[model samples]
Target: MKIDGSTVLVTGANRGIGRALVSAFLARGARRVHAAARNPAALEPVVAEAPDRVLPLALDLTVPATIDAAAQAASDVTLLVNNAGTHAVGHLLDMDLGAVEDVMRTNCLGTLRVLRAFVPVLERNGGGAVANVISIGAFGGTPSLGGYPASKAALHLMTQAVRADLAPRGIAVHAVFPGPVDTDMLDYVARNEPAFGDFPRAPVAEVAAAVLDGLEAGEEDIFPDAFAAEVGRVWRADPKAVERRLSGIT
Candidate 1:
């Protein structure tokens, strides 16, 4: 929906794309923005930028208590942005089970938890929108990212299901599939897997701006960057071929 005059809540707002989203929302004239991060102290810079409009919130998606607390604290939120996620790069079979679980918990179940907690809030506030920051990896398996793609794939499906379920309630559900973004998360992956070193990355501000633009345009599935748009077009043209290509990327 519209960003202006809306109360928004964004998770993982400490840095990277999340931080950019918070700024974009403010720039678009959101009445208030709840910037949630695992560490509230890390949100100081964002809050300082707009002390009256930004509220720093402590939220750890994996922690149900923190999710509940954030929901309670941000009752006026009309737009919810599920942007917190983790990447444990490795082969699924060889990676530590704990790491896989962490990825699933934060990316899938944790996002679901936030949605569940916020449904009533949205309903009470006359139903708004939910924007989930998923990835192009959701379309196919990336051997290097392992369970990270699997978790996102699950989230993509969940976003579709939620969209259908929430339509009658007036709450819009948008799924964002962004390709490599210039963020710390991608930096970490590039450091560990040289294969990603040459992948095209979109600026964080551009991606965030495109996402909001998509929402304003009522797009259910948003490919926010050039790389993502190209990959999405190819994947839709031939899913199997794209899968095979990704499989060969090492």
Candidate 2:
């Protein structure tokens, strides 16, 4: 759907790709944007950019009540961006079970909650689009991040299933797979874990712009960067091989 003059609700809008998306939407002439994050105060700088157009809301992914509240507050939303997610740092065997669970809880279950709450709002508003910020790693090949890839892969499957479910309802669900972007999340990973230090990163603004472009073009699956597009090609060529490689099975 076109972003111009459309109302959008973006989760995790305080930082990273979410913040870039908020700015990109404003640049593309979005009428109104609800920038929802865990702490609304963190969005003050964002609101300062376009006071009349941007509104900040409190939405903690772990808190279902807050998600429902945001949906209630952003009643005019025509587009929903599920961009909030957490990365649990560790390998599968050594990571604490709770940490791995947190990754799944935030990336998958939390996003599902947002989808459930805002889907009806979209339908009521005459149908719009839902952009799910998935990961290129979901298609498989990240050395670290504990259960992060697994969580995203699960979310990818869910996105496909939900797309089918929403097809009849006129609500389009788009899965966005982005490779390393130069964001705080990536910075932390690069600094703490040497594995990702040399990984190529696309600029946040460019990736954000690509996301909007893909949405307007009605692309069902969007690889917002060259690396992600390459990953998509590799995944498409041999899905089973990618799976086996990711699983460390020869």
TM-score of each: 0.99, 0.96
Clash-forming residue pairs, model 2? none
Candidate 1 TM-score, C-alpha based: 0.99
Where is the poorest 10-residue window by lDDT in model 2? 241-250
lDDT of 2 at 230: 78
Candidate 1 on 1-250: residue-level lDDT in tens?
A: 8899999999999999999999999999999999999999999999998999999999998899999999999999999999999998989888898999999999999999999999999999999999999999998898889789899999999999999999999999999999999999999999999999999989999999999999899999999999999889999899997788777777
| Residue 26 C-alpha lDDT in model 2 | 100
Displacement of residue 85 (Cα, Å) in model 2 is: 0.8
Q: In angstroms, how far off is 125's CA in candidate 2?
A: 0.1
Taking the tens digit of each residue's C-alpha lDDT, what string does model 2 give over 118-207?
999999999999999999879764556788899999999999999999989999999999989999888887877776777898999999
Query: In model 1, what is the error at residue 247, expressed in angstroms?
Result: 1.9
Q: Could you tell me which residue pairs clash in candidate 1?
A: none
Leading candidate by TM-score: 1
